[model samples]
Target: MWVRYLGFVILFGLPGALHAQPCGAPGLDGGYFVPLQETYSHEIEIIYACDSGRKPAVEGWWATSTCQNGVWSPEPQCIGEEDCLPPEIPNAKFNKKQNSWYNEGNTIRVTCDNGYELKNRDATAVCLNGTWTSVPVCEISNNTCGEPPQIPHAVIIGQKYQASFAADSKVRYKCEDGYSVEGAESKKSIFCISGSWSELPKCSRGTRQNTGHGSSVEVTTSAGSGTQTVGGGSGSSAGGTAGGHPTSTESGTQPGGGGRGSGDVVHGGPTITGSSTTSVSNDRNSKPAFIPVNECGVSPVIPNGVVVQTERMYLKYECNSYYTRVGPDTVVCTNDGRWSELPSCKEAFCVLDLAQYSGIGIRQTGKEYIKEGETKNVYCSYYDYVIFTCTQGRVTYTRCCEAYYHNYGGC
Candidate 1:
């Protein structure tokens, strides 16, 4: 039928022509369309579908979605990590209007008006990260995700003995004795989904290269969400969230990504913890010049840095909020400086989660990766708020408000 009226003119934008519709799936309301057979009715095929208990995040670069005419090519958006705000459920009546936020299967169709019927309610009341599940009583009885998320040094190849954990379960992630996941499909493993469990890949550890006078050391240990489990291995998520800065187990090779290091290697690498010395004198008499500290320590405050110090040993850097400076903004007075190689502020990738597109009235923010010409900003208040940049890493989209440019297909 003319490609279902060209996907209803690219989803109500009218005008005509323009077709692709990743199943017409929007967010917070559910997403996951599969109805088009009566002469292919009018067409609509969205996908993101979640809410039986929340837990359906799709954005590992877009999991899956394709349609090319009326738009809707690569729209995947149904993320979740436990975020149940707004009464979520006390009385209940969802498919609820969005202010921007909803995850996990995304459902809530309970009716307890007239005489109130639905004890162990199970028709739909998902949304798990923040909370909301089995919280449906309606004056009566009632009823009803994963279990393999413990990777700190990594280790779980064939360990079994579960008291509970069922639903396509899976587990085999490794990296314990010293941490490692340099490829090999990143060691791959972690499934249980729906009920929750997937999310754990990134062990990497072994990057201590100061080669100047040899003397650098750094160590970090974290485990505090009841003692860690569920990977929370922390940071690198990208797109679906977790864009840099949870760091700790870093040594360098790229492979994944994890920061922290560069305060002069943490303030102690001049024959091992001796630089921080201040005796500045460029040439007045030719003396007082001893400021080593660079194995990544001694001045590390990169949340959105600026750091600039010089007397002749030379040093200057910058990495404001939108961060993006990695190695050598300026550091001279040369003496074979490798000070263990320091320079990184990074952080800036896939942003925008108005609770997960609350109601879809229109919302977007950028970063989903950028480099080409640099530029990065993509916000919206209505619809079609595209404006992405970056060439080599690939991402090109544009609509109106182009503050910097969003990323990947949009508008």
Candidate 2:
């Protein structure tokens, strides 16, 4: 009976009948295992024990299967948790020394240097995960200066001038001779970059030299004034004296060589000059002293027999009236010595001659009806067959045209 019991025990203890020990099974002594589940698709944490007597943790997911005690179990997969975290993007710039992180959204900003404007958008950026999208580079904007003011005939020199500029740009200025600049000279040389001109410079009145001897002199030669002194003397000699000094000398007479007689007399002329005279015997006749010509005041006098008159709206001159038309009208000189031109006369109108019936007479030369100085032409016909037209006032030829007296009874 004891032998029979031993055999039954041996049969139950066979390799297939007893529980099989796990080869690399993870458990409480080495590491903790997270059971596989559909919801847990990512890496699961596994706490494992190392030979150093410290418990270490390994992360992995279920990879293979195993059988133990007639039951099948899922294998725990081991991998690094580093991969679970998102990858670190390189070359990402962070401001304020802030560290980049995953799962947390952050942003970054960019700027440019002075004198260099940003070419890209000035204000936005983003942080995705631990990385940032490549942002466009900030470039320098174009530099420019605006055009200068419109000073006609002015020239600008440098290429630095362009349309986009601020105020206070400098520009130069210059003007032609007869004209002068008004504003600040230095400022004129430079203009505001914005194109405005500097203050204008002051201009002075022009001057001219007069026609006589004094150093500085001015004369007003208008129509009324007969003579203006403009520096030189007129009758007596007034200038630098014999002592090399300037002086004005009036009329005076010197002693005569023979006997002291009455002194020679000198009269004033238009121009001034020095005169030396000596007394002579009253018995001897003497020529008059030298007198200067009238240089300042002299106007030409109109001569007689010169025809100075208006004809056909023009000035006409005739020495004799024999070859020209003669009339009672004439030009004359006024008391002021100024001559007047002949006035235009009135025209003559045709009138029927009751006695001669066929011929027409001047009803009244419209001369009587015309205004004092008005002019007109006159037309007449003989026997209602021939036509003649004459200009009133001065002498003029009679003109004959085909239509001279058409409707006024045949000429």
Models 1 onward score TM values of 0.17, 0.17
Deviation in Å, model 2, residue 101 alpha carbon = 27
C-alpha root-mean-square deviation, candidate 2: 44.9
Candidate number achieving the greatest lDDT relative to the actual structure: 1
Writing each residue's lDDT as its tens digit, candidate 1 over 45-88 gives 43345545443443232234444453444554454545554343
Per residue, candidate 2 scores C-alpha lDDT tens digits across 1-411 of 999999999988895645444333343333344353333212233323233322222222323334444233433323222212222323222253322122224345555442233343333244333234444354433322345554544444443555533223344545433323321121134322112323323222222233333222222222322222222222111222132111223333221122211111111211222444322122212331211112212322223234354321112334332123222123323324443334332233322222332234433332222221222333444332323322333222223323424322233
Task: Quickly count the clashes in candidate 1.
Answer: 66
Task: Show the lowest summed lDDT stretch of 10 residues, model 2.
Answer: 260-269
Model 1 segments beyond 4 Å from truth?
1-308, 317-382, 387-394, 398-411
Prediction 1 TM-score vs. true: 0.17
The regions of model 2 sitting more than 4 angstroms off are 1-145, 158-161, 176-179, 183-187, 190-411
Candidate 2 TM-score over all chains jointly: 0.17
lDDT of each: 0.40, 0.31
Indicate the residue-level lDDT of 80 in model 2: 27
